[model samples]
Target: MGMNEHDQTKYIFAQSIKDLMAKQPLDKITVTDIVKHSGMTRQTFYRYFQDKYDLVNWYFEKLADKSFRQIGNSSTLKEGLVKKFTFLLNDQIFFMQAFQSKDYNNVENYDYQCILEFYKQIIHNKIGDIPEDIMFLLKMYCHGSITMTVEWAIRGMKESPEMIADLLIDALPPKLEDLLSDLR
Candidate 1:
């Protein structure tokens, strides 16, 4: 259950970036700052990540994986959304800054892709085959949700996590909602 050496190292680097992000923007933070904060060498950092942006992606992916694992099969989509929103709220500063990154290849895309894949897997398992229209709708919904999430973060996340989750669930397309009714 404990972290392996590789994971441990990555965690350290992630923490360093998170701490730095609290005081500065992602674009302003450098690899040297991360290594210095993490007390690891540049070689150590490059061994695991190409840059801080890569670390941001890894951190978000880790959070997405952890959120799903915690939800498992017993929980609903609302529960999943609550957990994910909590993670974002808990690390508000880090996420607020990370969401501000102008880089196209950042957490926003990663979040959108992760959410889309999560829905696809669930829909595929529940209905066997997904129609083209449903798939398009699913992608559109995921993109909207992620965009809303980013705006929520950037805007200081004034709303409660549960409230945001409820709104997102309410916004789901009727057909998709019916398909994922049990989950919602």
Candidate 2:
């Protein structure tokens, strides 16, 4: 499906917020700054997003969707996770800004939830049947993955995405080894 004008405005707001965040914290940024940066009016900004937080949250949702789409094609689900981190590395500026935001716990916040849910979907696709009985365990995997990845991001991502991918693979619980281990 194509993006409508409202979605386009959201994109505009997202980019504008990212740009502003590069020079300031999230709390300091207001709707006016986002609209001014995007060259849109405040009313138009409000029509699409209630606040800067909404814009940032929505932005992460879109990014998660895009990243998940690519992850689906990876050779192994683990490899796809590395690819997702690499995607964030490619957008380091924004992620770093998000990482630095005040009142934000990158691993325990809205953006973290988006990434977690994306990973959950990937796990469901791989197993083909995510029974309700194991839902908590599935969420645990998602939370652990997002937490580890965001921790790396917050610490400047010293390890390359490939290395982080390998670490994540090594860190998987023994029970999941059969499910996530590479078949080839």
On lDDT, the leading prediction is 1
Specify the highest-TM-score model's number.
Answer: 1
Sliding window of 10 residues with minimal summed lDDT for model 1 = 66-75
- Deviating ranges (above 4 Å) for candidate 2: 1-3, 102-108, 115-134, 182-184
- Local distance difference test values of all predictions, in order: 0.87, 0.72
Put down candidate 1 lDDT per residue, 1-184, tens digits, no spaces: 8889999999999999999999989988999999999999999999999889999999887876777446545357788788889988988998999999988788888777777877887888888899999999998899899889999999999999999999999999998998775652
Candidate 2 lDDT over 1-184, as tens digits, reads 8889888878888888888888887778888788888999988887877677778777776876778456656778677777678878987777776766656533247755765565556556667776664566556766787678767877888899889888878777765656556522
Q: Among all windows of ten consecutive residues in candidate 2, which has the lowest summed lDDT?
A: 99-108
| Clashes by residue pair, model 1 | none
TM-scores, in order shown?
A: 0.93, 0.79
Please list the residue runs of candidate 1 whose C-alpha ends up more than 4 Å from where it truly belongs after superposition: none
Considering only N, C-alpha and C atoms within 3 Å, which residue pairs clash in candidate 2? none
